[model samples]
Structure formats: structure tokens, C-alpha cells
Target: MNATGEGEAAPRQIEVLASVRGRVMCMDSAYDVDEANRGRDVCVNSSYCGVLPARFIAEHRPRAAIGMDCGVGPEGSAIAGLWYLEALGIPAAVADVMTAHLGDGVHLYHHGIVSFANQPALDCGVTAGMAVREAAALLLEHDPVAAAASEITNRTVMETTPDGRSVVAADSIAFGTSEDTDRNVLVTAGHTGRSAVPYLRRCRPFGFICSDGGRGLNDSGMAGLYLVEADGLAGATVDARRARMGSGLSHYHDGIISAVNALAAAAGVEIGMACPQAAHHLLHRRPPTASPVP
Candidate 1:
């Protein structure tokens, strides 16, 4: 029993109930919207089959999902929700289904089964489910085992602007054993040429480490490299890159090695080469473009 004299259930139970509630609510709301929209369309078509309706169905209809914001305008909000779940000791696999609400206010709604093993109840403060009193009770009843779960999955929300593109970054630490440490490498695929360049420039002799094959740099003109001292990455590299780009969209070809370097420099840490062949193969395939010798 919990402080409130109620029996505490497992986390899995809480998730199951929440999932059921979310699903039912979502379905009912969607059905109502469809019915209203359908009725309106039928009326319009009956009135004038040859001409378009005065009001289009999309213009007057509400979305099927009440709290979801899947449009471009809400991309940042969606990403934020994903990060939030990750910070709570949940892995990305479980966090992906959570939806973000961006109407008049912002909120996250979990629509999956609540299980002690996977979707544990949130600690007391979260107001996503209901008022604190009800939310706490529900959580305790559903996911009592959460208290014993590992906290290593904790994460932090970060806002990053890569090449003038604003992105809500979710940063997490992934540790490795001695056996895996020697093979650890930082791998990033290039959508723009600048992706791997900044790190190479900042690391110098150590440079960014890469796998021997570097097969991951599939994009044309893309490059990849490994960080020799993964521990020494500070924020200097990223800052420099951001400064160079200014306000407008960054050129696809400009590598942002400098920005990554800034992050490494700021952290006062260095990362080791985990995969040299992968880096070499990628860089070799799309060698950095040359500028006229000054």
C-alpha cells in the first residue's frame, strides 16, 4: 500500500490502463471529427455536385488526434517530447510513440501499454495524466516497481542549430566496457559536406577517427572521420561553425567539423578512434573539395 492507503500496482499495469484510456479517447475523438466532416461534405455535395464546396473539408475540420502536431510548424515540439521521455530513463524504442501537443499549450501523451518492464509510471511531479493527486495514484497503482529500475537511461534535452537548422537535440551518455572501448568510434553520416569536416580540422594530429571502410558516408561529397581523443571535445568546434554560417541556411557542401570541435573543446574531453577503416573509406570515396591555393 502507498501513503494514501491504496494498494500499489506494478508499472506495467499503469501503462496498460493509460494506453487503454489514450486509445479509446483518441478513437472516439477521431470518429466524431470524421462524422462531422463527413456530414458537412455530404450536405455540400448534395447541394452542388458540379461546383466545389464553399468551405473545404480540411479548413473546418479538427484533426483526428487531439494533441498531436505532426506538421512542419510543430517539428521542434515533437522532437522535444521524444527527448523528454528519453530523459526519464526510457530508451528511444519506447519513447518514439509518445506524441506532442502544440495547440494553445504543450503536453506529452503516452498512448502505449503501461508495463513495469517497459513503460514505468512517471515520478510524482509529472502532470501529463491528470492532477497531481490522481496522477500520483494512477502511477503508484500501475508501476510500483519503477522505483527499483535503473536510472542510467536518464537523458538531457539540448537545442542545437546545425548549419543554421534548428533542432532539439537529445543527448545521452553511452558507456562501454574495456573490450568495446578500444573499438569505439564516433560515426556520423553527412547530409551536408560540412558534417565531418569541422571535427577533422579541430582534432589536428588526432583528427576525427573513422572506420577503415567508412562505408557509412553514402551521401555524395560527404566525409567521415574519427575523433582521436573522444574525451577532449569542447563546445568551441560547434560554436565556430555556427558563427561562420551566420543567419541564412548553410551550404550543403560546407563541413561543420568546427562545430563538433567546439563541443569537444567545451567538454574538455577527448574521444578515441573507434573505427578507422570506416572513416578512411568514407573520406576516400568523397574527398574534401579543394579551393584555389591562396
Candidate 2:
């Protein structure tokens, strides 16, 4: 897909986890897939295999793509993306939320256990319970196809807090812009992983919240909180069970707090508070000056 449009420079490389016959990349969100690495395989810690992310990967036409199953929540919405990719004849699969941290791609590659595989992936020797590295090897054996139209989901300003800050709901933090700055509070449906740190550090929103991804394996799901806290961003994650993993609107309306960084705690966010309440406190307060990055 020409989503990047004519003359768009190829996007810079995201973290490359391995390079065999083809590159094996790991990213925080599926939106990280781009024209630059069009045919490489990727594993993202978006915590859900929904069509939104699938479309992002399919748009780039990767040889294969893998994402977390996110407990295959209500209506199986979490793993629904697998079928979407299947229809496009792309090899795609998902790791069990329990076997790997939902937000850490490196962990997914090294420790994840495949819980589901679409027919295309299955045809290439990918199977449930297989090691991610083994599945990625099989993925490389598949041929890349022409790009499909990519769908970019839009973020919504759910409400303007009493203090004038916008409380934005985004299907993924990947939609955030530098304009969000200290003027907006973001509630995203993606996981809080280490890959999220760089994006948050760059965007510098007033405050932010995302999913805990069931706090899977070594608490890797919310691991980005401390990393961002070091940058002085007040951040938190809501329990995956309390809200859908891939819907920001569901997060804002149904989420219950699962964890909070120090800055968020200082702002009165608690583990059991409703997401709206926490977002309110975040909009009303600001973290200390973030340490300058190199």
C-alpha cells in the first residue's frame, strides 16, 4: 500500500531481533511496520491480534507478522486479526499471553509460545506451542505479496478535562503526535512495554495510560512505566481483565487501574481507581521536568 504516499522516504529501521534469510523485527506496536522493512517478519507486543494492527502489517506486506493473543478476550476480538491476515494470504500467528510478556517483543521472540496460527502460517510449518524463533524461521520461507490498503485508525479527544487538557482515546499510542505534548492526556489500548518508552519520551504527553497486558511474564507488560518515569512522565496501566485490550474507548470507559509509576502515584492514581478518575487526576497534574535525553 502507498500509505506513505509517493516520494515518502522509507521509515527508519525499528529494532531488529534477528537476521536469517530475512530480518526478524520486534516492535511495540504493529504500526511500527513500514515500507522500509516491507518483507521482513515482525513480532509486536500490541497485546492483541486485531484487524487494526493486522491492516498495518498487511499494508506493508511483511512475509509474516506475529502479535500477542491478549487472552482472546470477549468475542475473540483480541485474536480476530489472525483471520484478517489469513484472508490476505499472509502468514500470521499469535503468542499466548501467558507464555510471553504482551508488550515485550524480544521476550516474545525468545520465550513466547505460539498459541494460535492462521492457516497460511500453519501451512508453513508454524503451529501452536512452537517456539517463536522456529515459527519465524518458517515465516521466512513464505513469499511476500503485494501490499494491501492500510487502515489508519484515528484518535479521539474523548473529553476536555476541567483544566483544559484533552483526554484523548487512541486504539494505540502509535497514533500519538508531538502535538499531544503537555496539553493532552492519552488513554491508549496498547500495552506499556519498553518499546513504548522512546515514543512517550519523544511525544511528552501530560500523562498517559495503557493496558497491563495481564502483567504477563516478569511483569514485562507494564515494564515501560519505570523507563518513562525516569523521563518524568506520569504513566499507568489498566488491568486487561477490566477492559478490552485493543479498544481505547473500552479502556476509558471500563478500565480499572492495575499499576502506576511514581509520578502517577504522586498524582493520586491508585491501583483500583477507575480509568476516567485516574485520567482526571493526570490531567490536573504534571510530572517534574523530564531529564534531558541525549
Candidate number of the best lDDT: 2
- Residue 240's lDDT in candidate 1: 21
Give candidate 1's error at residue 61 in angstroms.
27
**C-alpha lDDT score of every prediction, in listed order:** 0.24, 0.79
lDDT of 1 by residue, 1-294 (tens): 322345542121111122321211121111222344321111101011000111221233321111222331342442232233323432111111223222111112233221111123333222333432233234333322344323332222122223221111111112112221212222322222334445444323211222122122442222222232244322112112221121111211222333233333333323231122222322222222456899
Error of 2 at 215 (Å): 0.6
Task: Write down the RMSD of all candidates, one decimal each.
Answer: 18.6, 17.5
Q: Per-residue CA lDDT of candidate 2, range 185-231, in tens?
A: 89998889888787788888989999998998999999998888766
* Best-performing candidate as measured by TM-score: 2
Prediction 1 global C-alpha lDDT: 0.24
